[model samples]
Target: MTAPETVVPTGKSGIYMPRRSLLMRIADMRAWLFLVVLIAFFEVWSRSAYGVSFILNTYNLQSISVFATAPLLLALGQTFVIISAGIDLSLGFVMGLASVIAAHVANYAALQLGLPPLAAMLVGMLTGIAMTIIPGLVNGWLIAHLKVPPFIGTLGMYGVARGAAYLFAGGMTISVSNSWYSTIGNGRVLGIPVLVILVAIACLIMHYLLSQTRFGQHTYAMGASQAAARRAGINVKKLTMKIYLLSGIMAGVAGVLYTGRFSAGAAQAGEPLLLDSIAAVVIGGASLFGGSGTILGTVAGALVIAVIQYGLVFINVEPFWQFIAVGTVIIISVLVDQTQRRFTGGRQVE
Candidate 1:
């Protein structure tokens, strides 16, 4: 009798099993492991420094929610652009411009046009989105059609958007009089902060977009190898434009939220978000080289940042030290990213 024929799994199953090992999975999820470690460290530190009850309080959770919301949104948007091997340096300035435009337009619509508060707020939201989107389109044109490097194109827009914000607000803060404007920033639903809820919803939507959509596949392909993606029939230029446009729209939404939180908009209001968002993205384990990122990771990174910030304040650390600490963390994150890339032969962790 012939020896029993041995059947070996080939193709998909063959490729998947080795990668499905526990060690491989752990290696793939090093970022999440780091996040968990950071969280545990912070939890211990906070309890020791501020007392366990204070650290565990619902109010403290709400405070972190407030601090994390803006950065979380910006990082989520940045993830889309970064995954396509691009960056949007204009995000912070675009947000400032949006906030200024929204505040002024909403005030005008409510006071001069005699619109209802809710109607005026809606107009403001639309204005913010438009203002933000226009710059994104311009950025797209510069980078895609004009062949400008993303850094240069977005850096130029960064300055232009900041200037526009200042010009629009006349170098002053524009206050919003309508109470409804603050609803999104301050109100809560079902005992959760509105900002937290918004962030959660955005995370879910973006997670779905990245994981389940063709656009996301295209994005990853482009990031992995632009030449390969082009050869495979991807429309590189249009996709690039759409990515930046989405980034700008998210910035606009963040702007509106900022205005709601403050009841006013200032030209420089979003300046701080620039570093924070980038830091969050990096800390979340998204490679600066692109092709890998996750919304959940970004959220965790945002929370980490917020926790550290609040924890430092609770421990009475000085303000300047906070900046130094954040900068240090960012550098460490970049180093970790570089190490991972080197070890993995440039394969990015997902």
Candidate 2:
């Protein structure tokens, strides 16, 4: 049988080394690893200062997860937009809108009108989406057509979205009375909070899209070289528009979660989320310059921020120091991103 068709081992081409690129494979796990390190540190600190059991009580289940929700959502949203070489500064405001919309929809009147509890919940989130789409459209038009600076364009939307948020709420908070409405925000699945589940799933979906799909390839292509992407017939403008839209959609989803968790929608519902969200993306080792961030990196970044915040609180570190510490982390994260980019510097052929 011709020696049973003895075959030679293939080279790198045949190696199933890793289907995931360097960044995609560990994006979420990296975030979790950061969490693990923080947990270890906290365990040590607690042993030294408060004793191990006290540490356990302080590093309690609720505390760890509570700090994570906002940052995780915000990071995911920021990751996609930044990869497209853009940013959405209005995310906090969209979160505020989410709070308002959810509360507004939760109104007994809307409930009486036959709106399902889930539909009511969605209404709150829809505002985040609108804010994203509107300014994303603006950002796209300016950057793609008008050639306006992405920084200035998105920054302007930030102010505008915040203003609209106040207008929508007239500076008030709203809440829902439906028990079912509360279930989503406050419920658990397999011992994991629903919000956590949602965020985790989103990470998976985004990571896959970024790593495996044609659109993702085009996204990097556009960021790396818009002209080249156009030359490659990548429909750069459409991609830009879609990317911004996705950013808005994420913010809106976060809004829904926020509304449910707080059981209220206020004009300022999502303010704190802004810092952690951007911080997470930065921490995850994604370049703000587009063409570089991986979803895995963003998740890591988010966890980093969450851990810092959690660590500070658990160790009784001053809250103000948390802010200062996070700012420092952001600088460090950016530096790391720059360094990796420099190391990888070459004309991106694909």
Q: Which predicted model would earn the best lDDT?
A: 1
TM-score of each: 0.90, 0.83
**lDDT of candidate 1 at residue 346, scale 0 to 100:** 58
Which regions of candidate 2 are displaced past 4 Å? Answer: 1-36, 53-62, 108-119, 122-132, 344-350
Q: For residues 1-350, what per-residue lDDT tens digits would candidate 2 score against the true structure?
A: 35665456676555644244566344424445555676687778878887654235633665556567776776776787777777777777766775676577666445567777666555545544555566557766776777667778777777877887778777777766755557777788777777778788888988888889998888888877788899998888788877766666677777767777777767787788887788788777666777767887777677667667777777798877878877876786566545544455633334
Clash pairs of candidate 2? Answer: 27-296, 99-265, 101-124, 102-124, 280-301, 280-302, 283-301, 284-297, 284-301
Clashing pairs in 1: none
For candidate 1, the per-residue lDDT at 247 reads 88
Candidate 1, run of 10 with poorest lDDT: 16-25
Model 2 vs truth, CA RMSD: 6.6
Model 2's TM-score against the true structure: 0.83
What value does the lDDT take at residue 187 in candidate 1? 88
TM-score of candidate 1 against the unseen true structure = 0.90
Q: Give the alpha carbon lDDT tens digit for every residue of 212-233 in model 1.
A: 9988889888888888889999
Q: Please give the lDDT score for candidate 2.
A: 0.70
